[model samples]
Target: MGKLRVKVDLALCQGHAVCMQEAPEVFRVNETDGHYPKVEVILEFPPEDLREKVMDAVRYCPNRTISVEEIPD
Candidate 1:
């Protein structure tokens, strides 16, 4: 399988944390003081083993802010 490049659109993220729930190893939801919570990509290029979970995050994101691109390995 090719490498996975994950991305999150912070402007569209509402901090639902669905992506985190789906793939904690690849995504993080940080809620800081005085700022709206946002989702962060913990692993921009996760291992092939985590591809399914990462894809789940992309598929289940409530705001549709998560995306993945396959890069030639």
Candidate 2:
């Protein structure tokens, strides 16, 4: 399997946790008292086995802020 990188743009993200729900291993969103933080964190390199789910998260993002790219080892 190949390596992949994930990234999220906070400016474009509206606190939607779709990516988080789809790929919790790759994306994270902190919640506080029912309110979610504006920033979303993307893991640098998710497990190669999770590529399909990561791609699903990318497609599920409404703002299209999520990005996944294959990296050279």
**lDDT of each structure?**
0.88, 0.78
Model 1 TM-score (2 dp):
0.92
Per-candidate RMSD, Å: 1.1, 2.6
User: Which candidate has the highest TM-score of all?
Assistant: 1
Model 2 steric clash total: 0
Q: Which 10 consecutive positions of candidate 1 have the poorest summed lDDT? A: 32-41
lDDT per residue as tens, model 1, 30-71: 996787789888889899899999989888887899888889
Best by lDDT: 1
User: Candidate 2 — worst ten consecutive residues by lDDT sum?
Assistant: 32-41
The residue pairs that clash in candidate 1, if any, are none
